[model samples]
Target: MLIFIILALIITILVIKKSKTKLQKTLNETVSNLNKTIREKDDIISELSKYQDIIDVQSKCDELLSNAQNEAELIKKRYETLLTFAQIEAEKIKEKSLSAKKQMDEQIKIRKVEYDNILSTALEQSKQIISDANIKAEEIAGDAYKALNNHKELEQKAKAMKNVIEGYGNKYIIPTHGILDELADDFGYAEAGIELKKSRQKSKFMVENGLAAKCDYVENNRKTTAINFVTDAFNGKVDTILSTVKSTNYGVLKQKITDSYILVNNLGEAFRNAVITPEYLQARLDELKWAVAAFELKEKEKEEQRLIKEQIREEERARRDYEKAIKEAAKEEEMLKKLMAKAQLQLQEANDQQKAEYESKLIDLQKKLQEAEEKNQRALSMAQQTKSGHVYIISNVGSFGEDVYKIGMTRRLDPLDRVKELGDASVPFTFDVHSMIFSDDAPKLETELHKIFNKNQVNKVNPKKEFFKVNIKDVKSQIEKMGIQSKWTMLAEAKEYRESLAIENEMKSSEEFAS
Candidate 1:
């Protein structure tokens, strides 16, 4: 029984030991679970703290939102109040404007009626004034017409008197109605020479015959002295008249001749016989006519000489120009040849880049050479062909006035040089070129232009004066009709002339202001 009891105790101890081990494991698991639960609780607490902070922030936001809402409400109310006041003020302004408009309308209606009355009265007054003015104008016009007629009659009488004075003491005598007319009818230097010789002989015969003068003195010496005195007086009068004869003074001299003849006849009458009888007077008149004709012939000869000299000078200038052109062309040709030779030499030994450059240079040089050759040929041809030249149309308004232009031709290589020479110090301003036309026959072109405008020549007495009073358009039309293409400067700049006028006007204005 004891052994059984011992085994039972040992079994009991083992059962107790097993229960203790199981308990220790259960305790360890429970402690681990507790620690885990504690950690979870701490995490929960941390989450709760975060949630608390969020809730606080949400609460703060709610509070701010509530405040904003309240402020917005307050602002809404304030704006509403202001809008009400604005509406009231606007209504008041609208009412005021309507009242003012009504008042303005009433005033405008009244003013319109008044204006209509004034306009009606003005229209009636204007019509009456116009009618009265028309009547006054008609009456004044009648007076003016009568006055004009009287003035015209007076002018005609004055003109008749002037004609009488200009007629050399004979109102019925025209310029070609006396001894001058007779001489012109059959006149020659040889015939005049013979007539002058006969005149001298007749004068000598009259003086010897005592027909030229008579004296009361019985003494031969006294009578001869008186006769000589009368003869000398008549001769002196003829000499005085003849001395005054000239191209410009022919008319005045003729009148002087008539007066001298009358005076001499009166002097002869004082000596008891007329010294200058009709026959003697005829002789003196013949001498005077011959003198006048000789003077005119000399003047004409001088003019012709001057024109010849001018032509010679022009020819000389043209020759010099031809020589110069030839020389210039030859020089230019030589220069181009030298350049072409240099370029060809360079091309012979040049690399690709340099060769291209030299070849291009040679091409240009060849073109230049061709141009130079052509120039040389042209210069030669021009030298050979004397007629080839430029015809220029130019104008100088400051010197010659408007509508006056010089149509001329020049054989110079540069035509403008001739034009420039013409516009030198001889004229107040430079000439404006209207057209410069190159022609194979420049002289023919110039002559044709001159012929077309011959009637419009400015200096009609001198054909050498190539100025014509013709419109520029007429010249251009004629040139076009000749089938010549030309550039025309229709409007003359007249720069210096216009500037001079402006300066003169400015000076006048300044003087006027100063005064």
Candidate 2:
């Protein structure tokens, strides 16, 4: 019985131990499954948090896009307003330009009308002059033949011729054997010599009688060639008249113009003995008519000169006035400098107000001194500008012959000394003074005179020659036209030249008789 009970107990114990082992194995498997479940739950929570973050970033991007659209709309509206303003301003500018253009066109038309009126008036005046010339020509033709027929009238004719030829008491006349062209000289002198041979007995008779001077004057003064004489005479007289008309003051210009009309009439009368042909006389008349345009040009030049002189005078006066102001400023500046220096020294002992006053005065004085110095420098620059010089009009008939004069300028105090030097050894005789004009800017005056006679210049190549084949009347006229005050002596008392000419004529007369 004990063995059976022990076996039963062992079996029971084995069964109990097996049940406990099974229970422990089951618990370990459950624990491992629980751990896997926990790990998967944690991964899911981390993925959900990542999705929430993406949602939040998308919301912010959408908000930013909306704000950018709003800003872009604002910028578009602003640009549209600016564009509208620009278009309006552009339209206004276009309208203004067109209006200005129209006004300019209107002014140009007005100027054109004024120019036409001036041209028409000038034409009428020219026609009147031509008519006067024709009437004078008729008078000369009528009086001339009758005068030639009567001996007493011939004496009057001779006196009239002398007055005309010699130019108001032998003033313009040079004691030369006429300023003849080479061809005219060769032909006319030869022809006149032959005629002179025929008139030797008559000349001898006149010499024996008291009519030698008259005969001698006629022979010396008369131009045998008609075309040359009329051309020269008309040119000379017209130039004079033109100069007078252009240069004379308005008060005297009308009288001078009327004198010009009388001059043409007188020219016809004076040259009637020389200019026998109608063709030559017509040419002279035509020349006087053509001279109208020339006169207009000269007047224009004179106006230009007047404007230039006015400008120069204005500049000079401005400079002088400025210089005076600068000197006064300098004087004031000196006074201020001394006052400022005293004030500066006093400032050390003075209070705040006085120190401030001293500094202000010092600054003002420095500014003034600077201005004065600048003005004084400008005055120095102006002082270096064209200084005064002497312009002289002189003639040497023995050297250069009739109607020729020298236009020259010098900076010398005694301009006559220069003239004397010129006449010393280079020329056979001394120079005759027509005038001496002093100018602040002599070069400008000299240049204008040269322009007047550029065509008639003796030495076109050499500016130093300063000689022109122009009459003294022309020179005087040009000078006077320029508003230059000059001491004028019309009498070209060529004493040496006349003596030399007399000696030459005496020798010629002796030779001609002997031959």
- Top model number, lDDT: 1
lDDT of 2 by residue, 183-230 (tens): 242343345445434444443444344332211124443533333444
Candidate 1's residue-wise lDDT over 1-515, tens digit each?
99999999999999999999999999999999999999999999987886787889999999999999999999999999999999999999999999999999999999999999999999999999988876787688977755665695456445545544665444333342244446564465566567667777777788788776666667888778777876688688667667766633555565555556555544555655535556666666667666666565456468878977976787678778878878887898899899988889889988887998998899998898888778878877887887889999999998888989999998887789999999999789999999999999998999999999999998855667899999999999999999999999998888999999999999999999999
Quote the lDDT for 88 in model 2: 100
lDDT of 1: 0.79
Report the number of clashing residue pairs per model.
1, 0
Off by over 4 Å in 2: 1-386, 508-515
* Candidate 2, poorest ten consecutive residues by summed lDDT: 174-183
